[model samples]
Target: MAGRFTGKRALVTGGGRGIGRAIVERLAAEDAAVVVADVDLAHARSAAEALRDKGFTVEARTLDVGDPASFASFDERLDVLVANAGIQTFAPASELTVADWDRVLDVNARGTLLTLQLAARCLREGGAAVTVASIQALLPNALSANYAASKAAVLSLTKSFAAELAPRGIRVNAVAPGRIDTALSDFGSEQVGRITGQDAAEALQRRLSTNPLGRIGRPDEVAAAVAFLASDDASYITGECVNVCGGDVMA
Candidate 1:
């Protein structure tokens, strides 16, 4: 059987843990040679080792998404790109320090641009790219202004790249995930609890209920969507942001 990505090569940022790791695993299982990039080189190597032990072709490398130099280095050995590296802090806009806001924007938005630029330079004419955004792109909250702004920029960036790369036969798209079980979300939920004095689980449950599906989504669910976007299955798709938000965003 010819796997969907049998001959593809993929570069996934933040591939050491959480949703990013799942995306890397899913792509490798579909027969793509994966490059797992993370800020934590140890975790990146461990994840790559685990995949390789399973007989997958994978390599680990250091990637600081907020740094363009990192992308320049990694682009030397890649094709497709998945910009899944991100961070968040919970606070009202008034309380969001300049440093925190800068960190989020630099990683989520600027980092995305750096990755896309590398993909445009390195990927073959028909190659694909996927940016991992968030439902926060559409559904803004008072506690996550910086995160939401960055995600909204991600969606815009995806469209801009799609337009710019369409002429070159390279496709660009994004997956906007809702609340999935991830360590990053766990940290954000804790911050939310501290700010609101509400139980983290209760806050999460209430948020999950807002989804028409009435539950939190899984990392694998988001990974599946990313795999599809990065595969030939979505060859004709570009300038689009797919919402895997469990019907939370109808548009």
Candidate 2:
């Protein structure tokens, strides 16, 4: 594993925390020169610093995934790109505001579009791209209208990019995680509890129940899937979405 990415240069958006940070750690651990990008420059710098301290080749940068200009500023060169930057909000369909929908889509959907566009141009032949979608992309809940739709768009984009980039030997794939143990997931769980009149504990269990494993997923678990997809081991894999949700949304 250490030499799998020995000379590779990888870029991960939203690599500041949660699942994104896990991805950064995984890639760096495998000996890649990883760049951690986030809108929150401080968090990005902190994550990169910690990894650097671990003797991994890591750097930090600022990125607003929703901004085309931000994407334009990134140098068009890299071996791997993980489109993991996204925001989630919870609200019933009836109460969903245009602002909320736009914000979510702008980051989750439009951002991914921009990310893939960057990858298409930046990634050399044999490069790989992995997007962080969500299980909600396939299974929508009462409060996931906006968030789910955004992730769904990501899945579609993953396939489209895969198809278009195949001739160049670039692979594109996605991971749909369910009830992952991250701050964003916790926020969604709490919001669900408030909407369903369940207490925090009950709501958490409710979320867990959807997964056959009866447990929340770990960031590292999702990261592992992403790493595999982005590695040469999956050279023949493209236009595919891997659900890392412990049997949730089996389709």
RMSD of each predicted structure = 1.3, 1.0
lDDT by residue (tens digit), candidate 1, 1-251: 23988878999999999999999999999999999999999989999999999999999999998997776565464557898999888898788899999999999999999988888888888889999998898876799899999999999999999999999899999999988888888898899999989999999989887779998788999999999898878888998988987898878
lDDT value, candidate 1, whole model: 0.89
Tens-place lDDT per residue, model 2, 138-234, is: 8756686999899999999999999999999999999999888898877876788888788877878866776689898899999999999999889
> Each prediction's Cα lDDT score?
0.89, 0.92
Off by over 4 Å in 1: none
Per-model TM against the reference: 0.96, 0.97
* Candidate 1, residue 69: how far the Cα is off, in Å: 1.8
- Superposed on all Cα atoms, model 2 deviates from the true structure by an RMSD in Å of 1.0
Global Cα lDDT for candidate 2? 0.92
Count residue pairs with overlapping backbones in model 2.
0
State the weakest 10-residue window (summed lDDT) of model 2.
Answer: 202-211
lDDT: which candidate is best? 2
